[model samples]
Target chain A: MSGRGPSNYMHIGHLVIFEFVKWLQDELDAEVYIPLSDDEKYVFGKVKSLKQAYVYAIDNALDLIALGFKKGKTFFFVSTRLSEIYELSVTLSRYLTFNTVRATFGLEGEGVNSGVVFYAAVQAAHILLPTAKKGLLVLVPIAMDQDPYMRLTRDIALKAGFRKPAAIYSKYISGLTREPMSASKPETSVFLIDNEEEVRKKIWSAFTGGRPTIEEQRKLGGNPDICVVYEWLKVFVFKDLKNMNEHAYKCRSGELLCGECKRMLADALIKRLAKHKARKRQALRVIDHFFLHEVEIPSEIIKILE
Target chain B: MSGRGPSNYMHIGHLVIFEFVKWLQDELDAEVYIPLSDDEKYVFGKVKSLKQAYVYAIDNALDLIALGFKKGKTFFFVSTRLSEIYELSVTLSRYLTFNTVRATFGLEGEGVNSGVVFYAAVQAAHILLPTAKKGLLVLVPIAMDQDPYMRLTRDIALKAGFRKPAAIYSKYISGLTREPMSASKPETSVFLIDNEEEVRKKIWSAFTGGRPTIEEQRKLGGNPDICVVYEWLKVFVFKDLKNMNEHAYKCRSGELLCGECKRMLADALIKRLAKHKARKRQALRVIDHFFLHEVEIPSEIIKILE
Candidate 1:
């Protein structure tokens, strides 16, 4: 299962992991659960409000649905929209504590984020919810930095009367500048919504394996190891070893120029995203097939809302 | 409005506040909202499990419904059963901080109760939920010790864009032993469900202001000021100045014997509870008139429970 924080727009950085999830779905015939942490983004103070996060979450869901996940197999929801998540979170929170959260997340002594403190349990609940529903093995594909939440969920799973959810860690995807990709920073990442020209411009300006001058690049060859374009090329352009190896060899032997490589990466991204944008527009019509619209909350209790 | 934590049976200590709430309901033509904190009881570690707390909460609701709160004007719900409370809580939690909660609740450095930490926000949500529904004046009939929750709600009221709920503090209702009444200890509290024999036995052994010897008590008179029986008489038996003052006068002047006064208190309690138990039995049939049944949780989302 996989989820994303909807504090920012879905960008290429997000697509790298989503592509992995899609591949898992295809190979294993896996059922996918994507729970957007709209509640967390607001509680963690990442967004101005839960509404704003939810708005972004809906858009992100469209982007994910556009990625060609199986209709019956994929279940998409945001945290607040799915009542079971909150119920499960409160149930799991019985085994969680403020001290454990503080210590695990480095929140000790700087005590002003109770929502965040409780949110750790919410994160744990996200991992174990599938197990809570049925007797099944739940596996999460997560980045290394988020392993703590998975570890905490695993530690308390049996105690909370569920199977311990397993996790496979993924490496972080760096930005074009070799730093972590930030959704809020537009220049550091390629957005899924960015047009072909925007994609080309961003790719052309992207960091690459190149020397100070053409003569030096030809003499010393280029350094693919430090090239951001080469890194993304491995992720986006070439999935096969033969094509990937050929591109790397050309860059290292000074047979391929940085401009030509950038153009290749840009063309690949434009073609992929153009198809994605078309599917995203189509995803809007069939959103109900994925979203959770009903829950356990009693309706008669509403007096003023009417 | 007033609510009792359903970690234990509905006892006399709880009745003191509920009776006051009933008075407010009668005098002000007010809308009553009683939200049993089933979530807090488990999160606060007061109950063994959320299920246990919910079981107790449902029974407590029956006891409360037996008290004859105006059917249409009164609304009763437990935390988890009402999806709207959790939604509002997440919205309000944005304004609450860990530092503020820790310092405000003396939870600083004691990291292990993230549920309790967030449960504070649930408490605020309960207080503000009525206000969130409409432009209404909310007055909570709370015991003195629980004022911190009220204060916290008020502090964040406008920041969350709701009217600040008002509060009228009730003095602590001490147990038969002159300590705070605890539902966990059956002897200290007279549960609404307790039979006549149990009520009589408890009151007979209850603490009193009588002298050690009969001759000394007659010579100096009993001190009604410290008498648990007399304290309860003011709440349960006497609703007027003449009877209350006359009872106190008799005790102070040695006209009312300790045994006789205990019998009076016990009889009053037995009579009151007998009627309450009968209504509670009847309340079972019309429970839907009070309990919140349907909510926002979509049925399609419940994959495993089916």
Candidate 2:
């Protein structure tokens, strides 16, 4: 249920993950705990100052809040301020060795920082936090990139006398340009904070699997397989394959033009983002409601060491 | 200023370091800060449980207090209990990369654990704790084994806009058997808690420079240079070169018997340890006075980041 603390504003890519988490919570009647790793971002060299990272944590939390999570059911914490979690991280770090982390992360050399190495333990703490309740089935909805961390968490959690928390992996949602979505590349992704005009502009210039010429596209047909806009529709707009199959069929048969697809996505994104923008404004007003005062370790887990 | 947390009972080997630390505090009028790294010991696989490490910390602290460090000028903390230190460690851990720690610690292939690797940051936090006050000169008196950590601490402290801590290195005091003193080889070391009978037995079996036969020793003189008794006498009992020279001369001339030298050292040690033992019992009654509630991060250091 935890998400990485964004060093910058989160884009639509992050929104998709939050949406899935919300769905899981509604379906299973689950509670979510999100730890904001501002300390981590500073240690990872992502932000120059801890204050800057702290601000990002707040902004990112607000973004999640704007996604319409139930206030009482969701809790957020910043790592540096949470001493209990840091202490737990120390305990978890002991269960793992340097070779295991290096092997798990493919960081067998000089580039990794001690902070980054220690962060694996902090991440593991997040995974096992719910197990304090014992028999609480925890389902982590994460992107495919986080699978390695999940594997490490599962291994260490079992060793520390906790149930193996399950990980539900999802694919990476590509950028508007069909490249990896990164905060550093502003043009490639649609930010949650992007205005209607900005969203339209980004989608209009996005990468699509259409032909170079309009006449060629009509004769040879267009392809939606590699289209970022189509992928967005498949992940966010359509819930069933029936409508998705129709869209793809029409796209491949040249009945749906690239411009028409782009217009449809842009309109839907604008409508969705406008509602999210309003919710974000509301979230900023009640930011304090979502933060956890302190993280509680389960007495059952504490008794193991005792 | 920074001392490692003791993992087991403090032996006579640790007394030498305490004596020097007491001398430095008096000579330089310096404040002493010692962090008990029970976490480090657990991470290093020295102790099975943190509770065991915690008990070692209490016993070790009593030993240090027995050496006569003034309460007002001294402070002690266990790493697991100090959240401020853990926070500071995260800040410092980010300044250097994994390659830096690996290169500094000679951890080429990585049999080391994550806790031990992260402890480098925890250790660094201890070094820089005093810099909260502007322009404080920190003098760390440690054995040769800790030089690598001191070097890393100094580098990170300077980079973090603080004074580079100065280290005063001392040689390791060998065991009675002439090997490095370790808790693993309990027979080789004289524990502070050892009774008079135990001390006498250990000393009586200790290595010396005397020849196998009295007739051989009378013809070819004993070599005091390789004698453990002479080394102990040189390091602990006798400070003056004149007195040391007389002892060596007596051994070389075959004027001193191995039995006589062992008896002399045992008596001196038993007397010294008895006094230390009495003070240690008294120290346990006032252990709380030496613990720091929270290590204050100096306003000057905070301003640098601000």
Candidate 3:
């Protein structure tokens, strides 16, 4: 399972994460549970308003659906869109304490809002929801920085009588610049929503591992280890990268230049994003099918909505 | 608007509050919104579990319904019984800060849970909900200790662009033992659901402001000023208190003894409770009509509960 805040459009960092999720889904035919935490983003100030976050969730969901996951097996739940997740989050919040959430999220002495503190439980509820509903143990794909949330969820799940979900922790996908490719810096990451020209511009202006001049680069060779475009190519574009280490070797031998590599990645990314953009348009019409609403709200609770 | 964390059965204190609510409704033809904070009770450890809190909310609601609140104007919403409140709470929580909540609640270093902190927002949402839906500012009746909640809600409502609610504050209703009548000391409270025998037992053994000996009392007169029975009689039982100073005068003149007062109060209470219990039984069947379901949940959210 993999999901995001959905307050911002899906970027290159998010694209790689979903690619990994799709890869796992293909290999195991496992059910995918994607929770768009619009509440978290809105409350945490990632988005200006909940309505915007919710709108972005649908927009980002279209992008995810475009990735070609099996529709029948994939379930998407937006935080504010679904009431059960809030209900489940409240249930999970009981077993978690303020100090635990604060200390776990390294929020001690910080002046974060109540929603920020409660967001940990919402995230935990997302992880354990499959276990609660389907009795299926979830295998979440997250980055190493999110270990605390995983650990916190595992601990709370044990106390709450839900199965602890297994997780695959990977490193942060470095940005095109020195900083991480995150919502904080829009220029560092290429968004799926970006047009071909925008994608090409972001890729062309991206940071790379190269010498000052072509003569020095030919003498000392270019360093592919630190090249953002090469890294993106290895992680997402070229699926068979184990054998494609030759690309890196060619760079080291000065057979490949930074401009030449940027063009190659930009072409491949433009092609992929073009196809994704087309599918995203088609996916928009069927967005309703992806949000499963099989929530077992108590009959008494049903009266609240009457 | 009046509500309590429904983790316990309604007692004498609660009865008085609701009586005040009924008085306002009768006088002004006001619409009453009673939200049983089951989530608050469970999260704050007032109840053993959310399920138990919810059950108690429904049961307490029956006692409230029996009090003869107008079915059409009276609205009953249990915290766990509703989804919109949670959504509304999240919306209100955005403008509130943890420091403000902690300082307002004086929960600085305490080990309160995340839900406990977020409950302030939940309560604010409850107060602002009427305004949010019908643009009717709420007039909440609360004791002095709950002023903080009202103040917090008013501040948040202003920030959230909702009209601030007005409040009428009263002092703590003294308990039978000089302590406040609350859930903590069951012996001090006469529950609406208490049987005739229990009512008689509790009222008879209650504290009173009488002299040590009957002879001393006869010579000096009893002090009705500090008497619990007199307080209950003056506050709830006898509505015409301006003329009922004669009863206190009788106690002061030693004409009315503690036994006579207890017997009068107990008999009156037992009769009132008996009527309430009878209506409570009838209330069970018609409770559904009181819970209005005209919640304007967005179509997007409707898919979440599908």
Which candidate gets the maximum DockQ versus the true structure?
1
What class would a CAPRI assessor give candidate 3's docking?
acceptable
Candidate ranking (DockQ, best to worst) = 1, 3, 2
* Cα shift from native, residue B226, model 1 (Å): 3.1
Worst 10 residues of 1 chain B by lDDT: B297-306
With a 3 Å backbone cut-off (N, CA, C), the pairs that clash in candidate 3 are A293-B306, A306-B293
RMSD of candidate 3 to true structure, Å: 6.7
Off by over 4 Å in 3: A108-110, A209-222, A249-260, A292-306, B108-110, B209-221, B249-257, B292-306
Interface RMSD of 1: 1.8
Give the Cα RMSD of candidate 1: 5.8
Query: Roughly what TM-score does model 1 have, to 2 decimal places?
Result: 0.88
TM-score of every candidate: 0.88, 0.75, 0.86
The lDDT of each candidate is 0.80, 0.80, 0.80
Q: Rank the candidates by TM-score, best first.
A: 1, 3, 2
